[model samples]
Target: MEEYKKRIVKTIQFIDNNLDTELSLEKVAEIAAYSPFHFHRIFRMITDETVQNYITRKRIEKSAFYLALRKNLTVKDIYHQFGFSNHSAFNKTFKKYYGKSPSEFRKLAPENFHKIQNKESKNGQIDTVFDQYICNIENLLNWRNMNLKIKVTELQEMNLAAVMSLGIANVEPSYNILIDWAKTKRLFPKENVKMLSVYHDSFKVTPPDKVRIHACMLLDEPLKKQEGEVFPETIEAGKFIIGSGEVTLHDFEQCWVSLFLWMKENNYAVRKVFPFEIYHTNFKEHPEGKMLVDFCIPIH
Candidate 1:
């Protein structure tokens, strides 16, 4: 798993460095040391788009940046800058995705253009083009309807030994302790352990490190008999309105945002300290289809 993660990071670096070139699946496969046939399948499975499709989407995304920031550059100039052979092909692809010509986009969709450019700019901390492309594609494919919601009523209280984090990035090591210690303590006894990660801060404002994630479990009674370091204080009991959605891995933020908006519209006041995720689908298991995360938001 660690090796695969390292390879994925290297692939991202390679793409960022060579976006101007023709990014071929065969070449990327070689970089990842996979056969061409298998690489295409894996790429789509991991990225939720064909290699060619991902490349084209990234090109268009970069074109959006040039359109907004380098206002003096002509449409043809921006097209060729992205290594498009001709302006017409560039216009065709852009229109296909955004529903407008380059000129129309510049004129009528200035805000969208600026938003893209600003997001891609330095200090913005926007993710790679591939991530953005995957997210947009997922949103187009899966939009939620409130009526489709499934309710889970009567969730009991939980006691957790936790270390809180805020605006923090890349704290996988810290959370490992929670998992490791819980096991050593035999917290779940005969019950199958359930892993829960709760996010307490909005990603938009909080730096990645500051995002609080409480890695915890639901315990059985025999385990609860043990006290002190063996058990932490009980997690407060509350009535929670649960809403869940399965989304492409890239579209996690959209799912979270949609759920938050739903709560807001329905007048549900969520406590900041208790946000949680029940991971129903592992990322490695289904790299393409959808990742299921069930959220429990306490309602007043």
Candidate 2:
């Protein structure tokens, strides 16, 4: 199982690195050192998307990001950069998913985006990196005299079918809703559905009324369209520090607190991208069993 997972991770990395190049089943399978027939089955089981669909979605995601986050690049440049053959194809696909032209999205997003950033950072006083929320001494004590096993890895871009939880009092209810949604949709075969948790706000910094969390499933298929709150998201490629442990779910907050302190102590600056958790075991299936979770924290 570990060996197969390594191969899948390798293929995911390969696809991310070559998003600007040609990618095909036969080619990607060869890169994974597996026959196309075998690779297709495992790849879908592990990732939830057919090879072709994953590439298409990833290309669209990269282009949309360029449109929104980058000021210098034009739509035509983004079109070619993501390997789209022409502007027409890219526009059609972007409109289908985003329901707006690239220009439309770029304008709509920034109106609310930077304001949110400023609000998160402002502390009534002058804005500083060590805001009152992050300067707590108790959080530092959580890491003192503690031993942790950490692995720093470069993870490939991950596309998720997520259920957004905004202003939820606790993370558990959101996770329950996500798992139930997965079961109703037949998205879990143990091997196919990977239960991942994404934290978009700092509990210490963001107020409970404004916190953001996502309960997500890694895909082997394109995200199914639904009228409910489920949405699609992509975490861009980056280097991350992974910390793993088997612990009671209630103690999970400590895990992150410890890691943040560890990052500060080691002089590692946190990346703007959110931190996420990848669960290795299904805890609902085993109440007595603690979870094996990897804290995927982006770093420079």
Which regions of candidate 1 fall more than 4 Å away from where they truly are?
1-142, 146-152, 166-168, 187-191, 221-234, 271-273, 285-291
lDDT of each model, Cα atoms only? 0.56, 0.67
Model 1 per-residue lDDT tens digits across residues 72-152: 679988888777999789888886655557787667433332122212336544332212322343353356463226363
lDDT of 2: 0.67
**What's the C-alpha lDDT at position 233 in model 1?**
28
- Error at 77, model 1, angstroms: 54
Worst 10 residues of 2 by lDDT: 112-121
lDDT at 123 for candidate 1? 52
Each model's RMSD to truth, in Å?
A: 15.9, 14.1
Query: Who wins the TM-score comparison?
Result: 2
Off by over 4 Å in 2: 1-147, 168-170, 222-227, 285-289
List of clashing residue pairs for candidate 1: 158-235, 166-210, 167-209, 167-210, 167-211, 168-208, 168-209, 168-210, 169-209
What clash count goes with each model?
Answer: 9, 7
